[model samples]
Target: MLLLLGLGAWAEKAPAETSRPALTVSVQQVNFVDMERTLSATGNIRPWQDASVSVQTSGLRLKEVFADVGDIVQAGQLLAKFDDTIIRAEIEQTRAAIIQAQASLEQATQNAKRIRRIMGSGAVSQQEADQVLATEKINQAQLSSAQAALVGQEQRLAYTRLLAPYDGVVSAKSAVLGAVYNPGQELFHLIVQNKLQWEASVSSRHLSALEPGTKVLMHVREDLFAEGTVRQQSPALNEQTRQAIVYVDIVPGAQVKAGMFVQGDFKLGTRKVIAVPRQALVLRDGFYYVFVLENNNRVALRKIEIGQSLPNGVEVLAGLVSGEIIVVKGARFLEDGDMVRVALAASETAAGAGSVMSFARAGR
Candidate 1:
């Protein structure tokens, strides 16, 4: 009877020993960080300067177009050509008239010189000599008029070829082949120098944060961030929207174009943050919890309010303090009031500590 009682007590003790099995977990102390706060906004991307190229002379047919929309060109590069048939013919006629005027002036000059020589010898009358001089002056005036006309026609001929005013991409083209165009008509639209900027509309309340050289991030493609800077801010609030415009000069070569709508944000300033490794977080019943390692290796599930999500951890806005130890790994397998054996082996502890330190450095 004594042996049976002893066996029964041993069985009861065996079951009790297995009931509170200790779980091995790795933990780290909460770290404090200073994180920059940002203000969100949406805006349109536009070129820094826009220009409208127009035809200078009237009544010309567009014969050829060397560039189209989206073509990159340089200053003085030909974009379109006008038919120079009529202008060429006019130029040729003016040149012929110049030749005729030159011949007439030369002949009249010779006649005046000969008449003056003979008038001193009494071989030519005074009245006749005066008439020769007058003829010479008339021919000179005619030659001057003809030369001026030639110069004007030559300038008009050069105007037949439309050229780019600056280095830019063709945003729009209105010139059609073989179509007649009038004076001062828009032939093409260009974004001057192909430079682009973001015009973000921010609320007037946050205007103080916006200043020249303030950092900005423009979201061009999904998951793509383009860095920029605030170049200027509007002087007053827009009467309609009660917002001010902030112009951000984007870094060149970003995959962005003018007239594209993009979302962006301005980094206002930084504030203190307390953070823990992401592995330490647990979600149950719409609440975030962390396994805090309490005295005697006991784990306590403490509710937490998480703020910004980081690359390697979550920011702890409330319910946690810096320098507190929390489970960094294997926290999901733990429960409140459970006993845990902290992984204290040299290599294991080093691994955990390294992870936490790396997370802190990255968050900065």
Candidate 2:
């Protein structure tokens, strides 16, 4: 009789021991919050305005280069100089020719006056007077030609010095000292105002949502971001890729550079969403899950569809609802049907203490 009684007692205690809690965790109710809707895209960084600086005169040797790659320059600043020795000699020669032509023209005018005065005076015939007048006219033409030559040489002298067209940063330099360059040969490349833009390629379906003045967040590096605004959108889409280019003007900063490939987000608008702390999520077999607290302190594993990621949490798109209790901490070690000990969070504990004090004061 004693052995049978002891066996029954052991069996009853075994079931109670087996039902112990698997872990201790904190729980909270899911709530709705305002989140911004965004469209993600990837593309390369480019200059807002790429200006090419080229030489206008041919057969001129590059004498000096004052600007180089990565140098900031202002408008009308001299960037380079060409050998003007030959050009200067030509200019002096043209001026001398003009002076000689003027002297000859003065002599011709005096002779023409003398011939007209002598006409019908028995000193010169009418035909001889006409020939003298024609000679004076030829001298006048020669003087005009010499003056035009002088202007042309002076214009060539101005082209010897290369000046910046606008304020910008030099990005490339191909000009070499003592090297002869031809007209239209590009010598320098400038980025106007040192400005940059992110040329992002986005799908055509999302083009309507974008417009000028829309906000953008560019990811320049890890833990770093640059603000941007939509300057314009391409009027047409790529026929092969079906994607359109969105030109985003980034705020001037050192964090971004031209030709860099980066990712960014376009803020379309805002919407209300249900979210939970990041700690409450668990990944299993390529799916995300959360532990939903049920009756009897047991947790049921629930799968969830996630949306945009927030700073401290993630948006729950589906499989969850507001006011549902879920494990906020210590959820990684939990499994389905496991019983857990629900510990009061710090905020809850503080609230409970405040209530106790209030009740004590009321009783007194």
Best by TM-score: 2
Q: Give the poorly placed runs of model 2, Cα more than 4 Å off.
A: 1-23, 107-130, 295-298, 330-340, 345-348, 351-364
Clashes of 1: 0
lDDT of 1 by residue, 330-364 (tens): 78877788776665546656666532321111110
Residue 151 of model 1 has an lDDT of 93
* Number of colliding residue pairs in model 2: 0
Query: In the order shown, what is each candidate's alpha-carbon RMSD?
Result: 7.9, 6.2
Q: Candidate 1: global Cα-lDDT?
A: 0.85
Clashing residue pairs in all predictions, respectively, total: 0, 0
lDDT of 2 by residue, 1-364 (tens): 9999999999999988778888877787888999999999999999999888899898889999999999999999999999999999999999999999999999999999999887899888888999999989999999999999889889889999999998999999999999998899999999999999999999999999998999999898999998899999999999999999999999987588899999999998989999998989999999999999897989999999998899879999998999888887778888899888776556757777321111010110
> Which of the numbered candidates is closest to the native, going by highest lDDT?
2
